[model samples]
Target: MSRASLASLPATPPVLAEFDELLKMRELLLAEPDEATASAVMRRFWDICCGTTDPERVGVLEAAPQYAVLRAFFSVRWGIHLRRLETLASREILADASATDLSAASMLALENYRGIDGELDLLGESPAHNAVVLGCGPFPETLIGLQHSALVGESLTGVDRNHEAVALADAMTRRLCAPRPTVTITHADAEGVDFPAFDLVVVANGLTGKTRLLDRIHRTAPPGVRVLVRNPTLLARMLYDHVDPGPRSGWRVTERRATTALSETLLLERGEHA
Candidate 1:
C-alpha cells in the first residue's frame, strides 16, 4: 500500500484530536517512564494505530501536518526507553549464572529472532558461515539471539552508526560470550560496509533508508546470499520502517513471516540478474 500523501488537504478534526491526545500521553510517559505506565501507554498508542478495523487510521494520522514532528517525538522517546530497558536487562543477563533471567522485552525479542530462524530453516537457507547484522543497536539482541540458538556457525559482525552503542555492544559481547567471542561489533554506516564479505545480512527495524540499503545489497551481495529484514506491520507502520523487496534489480523475496503484532520478517536472496 502507498503511504498516506501529505498534500494540501486539511486534516480532519477527529484526526487532529487523536494526534493531540497521543502527544499528551507521550509527554506524560516521557516525564515518568515507570515500567507499568510505559507498558500501558505503549499499548494504547499501538491500539490507536493498529487495533481498529479502520485501516485508514494510520493513513489519516500520517497525512496530518504534525505527523513528522509527532513521529520524531515518538521515535526518540521509544528509542530511549528501549535502550534503558535493554541495558538493564543486559547487565542482569551478564551477571546471572544461568544467563536466562531476561527482561520481558528481551525475551520477546528473542522469540521474534527464533521465529525468523524458523523461517530461514523452512527455506533451507539456515544461517551463513559469515553473517552481519546492520544497525545492531546498543543491546545487539539479534547477534545474541543468533549465538544463543547456535544459528551462526563461524562468525557474526554487528554494524552500528553510533559509537557509544558500538562500544557497549563490544564490551557486552566479550563477557556475555566469555572465552571465545564470535561476534564483533563495529561502528559503520550500512552504505559504507562491504556487503559482499558476508553471506547473510540481517537488517534491523530501527534502520532508516531501507530502500537505499537494499539497493546497495542488491548491487554488491553475491548470488545465493540471504537477507532478513525486520519491518513493522499493520498500524505498526507508524512505529517502524517497512520494505517490499519485490522482484528488484537482483533480489527476490523468498518468504515473508509475521513474527509479532508489531513486526514482520522478509527473507530475500540475491539473484543472478543484476
Candidate 2:
C-alpha cells in the first residue's frame, strides 16, 4: 500500500527477520501451506487491528506476496475491527463538531467523498436519484456528500457487511446529512447482498476483490447504470492491488476522475464498454 495510505498506521515497521518469515509464509501457503505460521500471523494481525485505529495496518503482512491472504483476511475482519473502533469513536469523539472526521480513516473517507463531487457534477443532477454505495464503511461521508454536493440523484443507499456499521451510518446520516436527500443504510456482505438496480453504483474504498463487486454491478444493475470503482494508484497498490480487476474482466475504465490522494477513481458503465 502507499505509505500515504498507511498514514494512520504505526510509525515503526517489523524487523527484517519477521518480514522474511511473512514472505516465506506466503510462499509456503501458495505451495504447501503453513498452518502454524498462518495461525500466529493471523493472531498478531487481529491483535493489531483491535488494539489500534490504524486503517490498513501497513506492514502488518510485510510484503506483496501475501497480498491475497491479507486481502481475504481484511475482507472479513474489517467490519469487525472498524466497527469496534467506530463504536468507541462515536462514544468519545464524533458528537463534537471538531471531531467530525473522527480519525485519519474518516478524514480520508470524507475527502474521497468530497472528491467525487466533480464527477457527479459532470453527470448532472436529477430528481429522486437512486444511488447505492458498497463498502460504505463506519462513516457515511461519501453517501452524505454525494447526496448533497453533486446533487447525486435524490435517494442514496449505503451498504456494508457490518450490521453495526450499517446502523451507525443510518444514524449518522439522520444526524448529519442534508434532509433534502433521503438516505438508507443496509447490512449486507458484498459477496452475498441482493444487488439492487441503481442509477449509480459506487464500489467504495476498503472493499476486497473490488473487481467482484464491479462484476456484480454489471450483472444486477440495468444497462447504462453508472459504476464508479475506487482503485489505488501504483503507490497504494500494496494495499489495494488484491481487489483490482484483471484485463479480461468485462468492466472497463470508461473515464478517470480525481479523488482523494489515496485513490484513483474510475468511471465505469454496466453491461457496455465506453
lDDT value, candidate 2, whole model: 0.59
Q: What are the per-residue Cα lDDT tens digits for candidate 2 across 1-274?
A: 4324433434334432333443443344445335455445544544443343334444444454444444544434434444455555444444665544434344434455567676565455443258888888667667867766645546788998877778778877776676766788888887675455577877776677676667777677766677777776432444454354445666666677656554667776544433
Model 1 ranges off by over 4 Å:
1-12, 15-17, 26-56, 97-119, 122-127, 176-181, 272-274
lDDT of 1 by residue, 1-274 (tens): 1124322335548746877677678567758777888867875776676554355666766677767756766676666655665666566666666554234336644555456555455346365777899988777767776766566678889999888778767766765553332789988998787787787899988787898888888778776778888888765666667787665446787778877667778888777544
Highest TM-score, which number? Answer: 1
lDDT of 2 at 58: 42
> What TM-score, over all chains together, does every model reach?
0.78, 0.63
lDDT of candidate 1?
A: 0.70
